[model samples]
Every structure is written in C-alpha cells, then in structure tokens.
Target chain A: MTQNPQITPEWIAVDCSATQMRATAMGAAGPLAQATGETSKDLEAALLCLIAPWLSAQTTPVIACGWDAAPFRAVPCMPADAATLVDIPTEDARISLRIAPGLSQTNPADMMCGEETVIAGALALNPDFDGVICLPGLHSRWVHVSAKEVVSFQTFLTGELFSLLSQPDDTLDGFDPTAFEAALSETLSRPEKLGAKLFSLRAEVALMGLSPRAARSGLVGLLIGTELAAAKPYWLGQPIILIGAPGQCDHYAHALRQQGITPATLDAGDCALAGLSKLRGLL
Target chain B: MTQNPQITPEWIAVDCSATQMRATAMGAAGPLAQATGETSKDLEAALLCLIAPWLSAQTTPVIACGWDAAPFRAVPCMPADAATLVDIPTEDARISLRIAPGLSQTNPADMMCGEETVIAGALALNPDFDGVICLPGLHSRWVHVSAKEVVSFQTFLTGELFSLLSQPDDTLDGFDPTAFEAALSETLSRPEKLGAKLFSLRAEVALMGLSPRAARSGLVGLLIGTELAAAKPYWLGQPIILIGAPGQCDHYAHALRQQGITPATLDAGDCALAGLSKLRGLL
Candidate 1:
C-alpha cells in the first residue's frame, strides 16, 4: 500500500495468498532481498510495484506458487517442483514467469497451492523424510508424505473460522493462556458441543463479564481443539513437522504437545525460498 | 420504513430484533393491524414511526419484547409473561412501554430475548402441553418444556453460520435437495469431520465444479446435520413442537423427519402476539 523499495537479484520466488504476496530475491548464494504486497486484485500490478526493479533484459525468471488459475494436480503424486511450473505469457518482455501447480483430492474435495512448494523444499532438504506435514495458515493442511511423494491430505477451516468469529481488529496479542487451555480441554472432550460452545462466548461477555482477550482465546482454543479431535488420526502418533510462521507454529505446537506429539517446525518463508531455490537449480 | 397508515387499537405487541421490529395492534376480538420497521439503534423512534396514529390521550399500552436490555431469567421457569414486564418511561405520556424478560442458563451461559415470548404464547395456547420446542431463527434454540416450565435448553449457531457462509443476496430458493440431504446424512453419521467438511464446499467449487446452489444447500445440510447429531438427546423419541418462521420450521422438520420424528409447529409472529395478549390480560 506504500512505496516499495527496489531490489535486484538473479531470480525471484513469490508466494501468493488472497490478501498478501511475498517475494524473495534470490542470488546464487541465497536470498539477497525481499518485498511484500498486501493486495488481492491485479496481482501483476501489485507484483510489478514490488519487484519491477529486479527485472532485467537478460530474461529474468520468476517462479510463483498460489495463483488462482494454477492447475490442481491430483494427489498420490510428488510435491510441486520446477517440473510443475507452467509458463505464463506476460506483457513484459524481460519477465519469464511460471506458476507451480497446486494439489487436489477427489474424495473430500480439498485443494491447496503454496503449501506444496513448502513441502517440496522440506523434502529437498531431507530426501528420505516421510510423515505428516502441517502447513498452518488461513487454511491449515495436514499432508501425508512418503518416499518423496504427497500421498493425500486434509484441510481444516479452523484458521478461517477463527478469523470470521473474532473481531477484525484483533491481532491475538494478549490472549489468555489459562482460558485458552481450559476451553481447549473442554472441546477436546466434548467436541459435539462446538455449535453451542461458540455462542457461549458472546453470552459470557454479556453475563459473566468475560474480557475480549479471554473470549478470543476461548474461540481459538475451541476451534483448534475441535480440529484436533477430528484430526486425531493424522497426528495421534505420526512424526509431524509443522511448517508456518513461528507464532502460528507455536500455538499448534502447544496443542500437539498436549496430545503427546513433539513436532519439529520450519519457518514457512524459509521453506518457500528453499523450495524455489531447489526449483531454480532445475531451471 | 414507509408512509404511515392510520388504524386505532387497544394495545400493541412488538418483537424487536437487531435488524427488524415487527409490531401488531390488538383489538377486543383478535389482531387488528400490523407494521414493521427494518431498522435498529433507535427502537423508540422506529416504534413511533410505525404506530404513532394508534397512540392517543387515553395512554395506549405497548407490550414489547426482545429489547436488548431485557433481563434474562434462569431456566426451570415458565416462559416470560406479564410478570416479566419491566416498565420504561418514555417522553410521550400516551405511550406506556414495557419489555418482557428473556431466559438464561447458568452452566452453559446461554441467553435469548425474543424466543421466550414466542414460547409463552405457545404455552398459553396449550396450557397442558409438555415437550420440546424448537425456535428456528438467526440463533436457533431447542427447549425442553416439562410441566409448564422450561427445564433446560440449548442454542445452536447453525443459522448464524449459514448466513455467514452464504452469499448475501441468496434466498435459498433454488438450493439442491439431493446435495442437501446427502450432506445432512454425511454429517449426521460423521459430525467430527465438520471442520474439514466446511472447507470442502470451496474446494468442491474449484475441483468438482459444484454449483453455488448445491454448495449453499450442502452448507445448510452440513450445519443442521451436525446440530442434530449433537442434539440427539433433545429430540430422540420426544414429542416436539417447532415455533418460528414457517419456512425455517419446515427445514428443521425435514431434518427431524430423517430421524423419524414429526413435529407440531406454530407461526412465530402469531405466538409473539398470543404471548403479549396473554400478558396484557393481567394489565
């Protein structure tokens, strides 16, 4: 929304979501610079605003994941890497762009775009790694990976529901840990009462003098706890790696620890850059 | 929200909600006239706008329910009647305003404002009736009425969630029955998968080409089915009465029928008037 600073590098890696796009300028050594655009419509215009200075006449390549038009590849396949990129015709002659295809499952009808690239980077770093991978964000995914291939996955609407229920101005800064843990345990035991439990927050505020912080925390715990109940099979005993923002991963880690799972975590941005770098090697 | 039409009556009954207020004028025999205002924030002004002609020097009594400030009485109590009315001093001497208190439950921390008056009307019409009462609205309630008292009740956020997830302009006229019933059955059997099932609607649109109508129907079925799954104890083999908008009651009836229960029903507006009329008897 403000003036973007210029950054020039050999290539670029961009991860796009509905509300934001983050680009990492990549040099042979590693990430040389970064830029972010908090925008939705006219992605090309937004990207140009942030990354135009990096373009050159040498035909600089830009690899992107999470375009709305990206094809969804059926699961029981490998994570999207360089081979999955489809050439995108652009107005700029100096820009050569391609987007990595996302993944889809037919039975439960699940889809995702950027998380696959992160999974690719994780696998690239650990060639023989196999287990469950949770990429938490607006839509959190629990993916099953084996022998460098994504077997199948499920997506939970917990993050989206939390956003919808909480006040828009809320940033989860001063949430009550005690209220959160209490509500978490409550929902984990009585997941059936989720519908009723949601309304109680509003009632508690009116009748019991519940603070907004506690209510927000209770909402988070209730949603995540119910998700944990449903996703029991996914994380009950599986070796898990949570890939996301550090704060988000910490919340998930707390819940998983409650269920007796010690999950290793990787920074989502780092994995995205690593994944794109691995793809760049192929390009 | 339109030009006033003049008609005089003995007293007025009103059901006030955040979005709309419906007022009914009562005569010696039965209802005489009606007015509605689709507005909020200024309830006294909205009421006067709709019923100013009916107010006169004799000091017309206004029996109102569902005002936000109405106190909530605990359960194991009869529906709100004349005794629940709390007087409000107004600027005009012609208006004697009173609001009937709603109901609350302590353990679950639930509250209701308008539905209690509707329940009172249903009870007034059938003094000996004892069973479950379902009031379907934005925040639906299921009540356990036994021996002329509300033994306990539960509130479901299904309707609110439905409105939240649905397109603003959609009226649910063209929803797919097959998809609705199928989704209902799916959640009735496996309600734990609700968090995943919600996201599936969006995924279905992309990967499966699910029509918006079908998606909307699926959402309704999913929420209702999950609520039914949780509320099995309330409706399983128990005689039931549904009091709300006819269309909303019909939807609840359809799902109840799947569980092999047929419910007796009442129009919500009629019940609100009958309730207020019953309360007016004491005045």
Candidate 2:
C-alpha cells in the first residue's frame, strides 16, 4: 500500500444542498484531513463518496458523522424527528460505506415545511436570541427564536410584494433598490415618529408629485420602519443578527443602525455550513 | 322683445384636466348641469349643446368658471400669471381651489393648503362642530374647524396608502375588504395602541406567514390605527366627522367606533361639492 496511510475516517460534517455537496473530515485535533465542496446533481451519493473515498479498501471506524437537513429531505419527516439518525446500507455500491442520514422534521400541511435549516443556522449564531429574526427572501421569515430554540416564527410575503410592486404593470415598477435601502436607513433612525411618516408615500406623490418610483421606495421604507417599531420591545437590547446575502445584509444593517441597534450579519450559506459544523462537533 | 327669457345655461362646475373635463351640474343648475361626473372628448361642449335647445336666449351668467391652476383656465379669461398669485396652484384641482386661488391666505408650499374647505363643509353640516374633522382621501386632512375657519390640521395619506397596499399586487391584494374593514374597526376601538399595531403587518407575515394580500390588509389596518392615534389628541370630546367616499366612510365609521370616537360621515364628493359651495357663499 502507499506507505500504510494512518488516516482515521472518523467525524464527518456534510452540507448537502439541492445542487451541491460540501464535506469535511475531522480526527482528534479537529480536521485531520482537508475539505471538499462540489456541485452535484446527486448530492446524497456525492456526499457519501466525499465522506468515505476508499471505504472498501480500509476498515476505518466512522465514530460519528452528521449532516444538515438538506439531504434525505425529499421524504417528509415529522417535527419530533429532526436530527434523528437513520442507517444507510453499504451494499449500495453508490455510497460504498455505511452511513446514517440526518432526519429533517417538516409540517407538510403548513405553508412552509423545510425552513428548519436556516432557522437552526440562525439560532446557532445566537443561542440566546429571545426575540425576532427577520430573514428577507422570496418568502421572508420573521422568526421568533427564543428559549434557546425557535419557539415560533411567521413569514410575510414581503419579497413577493416587492416583486409585485416592482413588476412591469405595478404602479411602482422601476423602483431603485439602492435608493430604497437609503430611505429604509432614514426611517430606522427615527422609528417612533415613523407611524406618521409611513403614510407619507402617497402624499409625497399625489400632493407633492414625487416620482412613482420614489413613492415606491418611500412605501417600502415606511413598511420597514413600521416593522422595526413593532418588533422593538421584543428584542430591544438584544442583538439583531441578519442572516442573508451581502446587499440584504447592508440594507438590514442600515435599518438597524437607524433604530440605534447594530445588526450582526452572516452569509446565509456560510452560516448554514457553520451551523452544521457546530452540530457535528456536538456529536 | 326677442324672448329675453330666463335662460338657465346650467350651473355647471367644470374641472378641465389636460385631456378631460370633470363637469358636475344639477338640472335646476342649467345646460351643463346633469350630475357630478368626469368625461373625455368634448362632453362639456356637448352638454352645453344638449341644454342649448332649452335656453330661451337670455343672458344667464353661465358661471362657466374654473378654479384650476392650468394656464388660461377660465372659459373666456384664461389662467392668470401663476407666479404673481399669493398661492401657487396645487397638482390636484381641489387643492388649487381650496387654499390658494379661493382663500389666498394658506401657505402655497404647505401641505394643508385647502383644508379649510372641508372644515367649512363639515361646519355647514354640524355648526356646533368645534373639534376635529377627519377628511380622508389622497391626503387626509385632520383639521380643527372652529369659528368658521380652519385652525390647524395634519395630513395623513391613509387612504392612498391603503389603496396602494390593498391593490391586487399589494400586500393585501386578495384580502377580504369587508373583513379588513372589520379588523380596522376592532383596531380603531383602541386608538391609543395603534402605534404598536402598525408593524403587525410585516410581523404577522414574517412570524405567522400571512398571505401577501392579507398582509396588505394588515398594513391598512395598521395605518388606519396610526391615523386614529394621531387624531386622538384633537378629539376634544367633539363629534368626529369623517369626510370621504362611501367605502371610505364605512371604513372610517368602523375605525371611529372602535376608538370610541362615534364618527359622523359626510359624502366625500358631496362634501367636496359642498365645500366648493361654501366657497361660493364666501364669494
């Protein structure tokens, strides 16, 4: 053999997404081997291959291996079933070595079923987050993560509303997201007096003849301000960590700063990876 | 005598837009008089001909006057020098007539230029109305009409924002307007807490995953709640008079009852017309 390799295929951390596989091999001193990330049409099989590259050649003991709730999510899982481990057989040449799939709990009946990963990742960033964490996306989430867990959360169709308002036929189709973000910052600074300013969008137009696009931005700003005022008491002195993309992070950061609250932002994908890694460490 | 008879040419009020004419006249009012409405493609000249067959060749003051700010707005006289006038013309014809052209005392740049007209119209309905008069529209004017003049007022774009937010693609596109109105009533019942409810729109959607349409209605309720709160200080134990269209009247009535304000509604169009008529009295 090649000088008798002494690498123990022990702890494995995997983040299997819809189109990608990211895996890391760890030993006693943390990350005994390197990590590999790949774009894969078949994330599960690819993940297995990444975890145990030469499973049949060696009798390495896999002490512990954990994965995020991305793979094995096609089959619906129960709420109480999240983080549960399921055994996968080795006879399947596709994977080569035996592996345990991570369980994901989702309420199929609910409007949103598979949102636990992001929330879990967001929670991992702040274990003591007792208030709301607004995750802006195509389907925005206003999660009330508290008591060291996500107790409850709500999703507003803000992203969809923004799309509609910015669509070709909508009254405010050509709104500039940059200017709107600036306006959002302006509103956050004086949240208490925002209730009166919130209604100024239309007046700024019909009365003062502001541009339709500017009106749209103003409307978005007003709504964001209203949101800050509403969630203020719940998370007053607590840290508001915005988990999203770069631009969304800046926008949300500006909003929080306006309300005298500094926001902590983390790349959503990176956060997801880190969270999975943290969970892997526990095992 | 060549029939110098009673020629009622129609006591019509014509608002000539750039491309259309909004003419309202009563039959007893004359040739241009029919009812309040808007028309394009020469409806005004047509209406004049429609009643021409009835006039008995007498010199009845057609009263073909326009209070709009367009150049040469008068039937025979044309718009005067706008720069020289004490008050500049407002974009909306009504505002031009309310505070600037007719009253001449209001600040040309201020938002509440024509607030007195609604106040006067409300006073015409309830002479003892010494407190607040809530006028709902593009720019809702909350005025203190005492001693036959507008004392002070604040403008809220509640109606416009509600319309925008409740639009088909807005946050509340498919929401039940009736239920939204009901919620508004419930919210307005406790006006003091309106500020807190303002952010519930985004929160309910983010936390509870409310529908885009439902979220829009939630925003309306929130905005109306804020409006009620802003108007509370001016309540002064006087009867609240809501001036807007039928739908607006119902919404405000529900909101007022919720706030323990017991509002008396006046038709928006009729009040507008009545306000014009009040200006007529002043003339």
Could you give the fnat of all candidates in order?
0.77, 0.05
lDDT of 2: 0.49
> Candidate 2, after superposition: displacement of residue B122 in Å?
4.0
Query: Model 2: per-residue lDDT, tens digit, B68-185?
Result: 3322211111112223234333232312222223222122112333334444455766666666678676556666666555555566656655555454554322545654665465
Model 1 bad stretches (over 4 Å): A1-8, B1-6
The TM-score values for the models, in the order shown, are 0.96, 0.56
Candidate 1 scores a C-alpha RMSD against the true structure in Å of 2.0
lDDT of 1 by residue, B1-283 (tens): 3434455688888888768899888888878778888756778888888888677678888999888776689887888656668998878787899988888888889988877888888998888888899988888898999988889999988888888777898765886779888989988887877889999888999888999889988998999998898888999989899988877788889999888999999988888888888789976
Best by lDDT: 1
What is the TM-score (0 to 1) of candidate 2?
Answer: 0.56
- Positional deviation of B93 in candidate 1, in angstroms? 1.5
Error of 2 at B23 (Å): 2.1
For every model in order, the TM-score on chain A comes to 0.94, 0.53
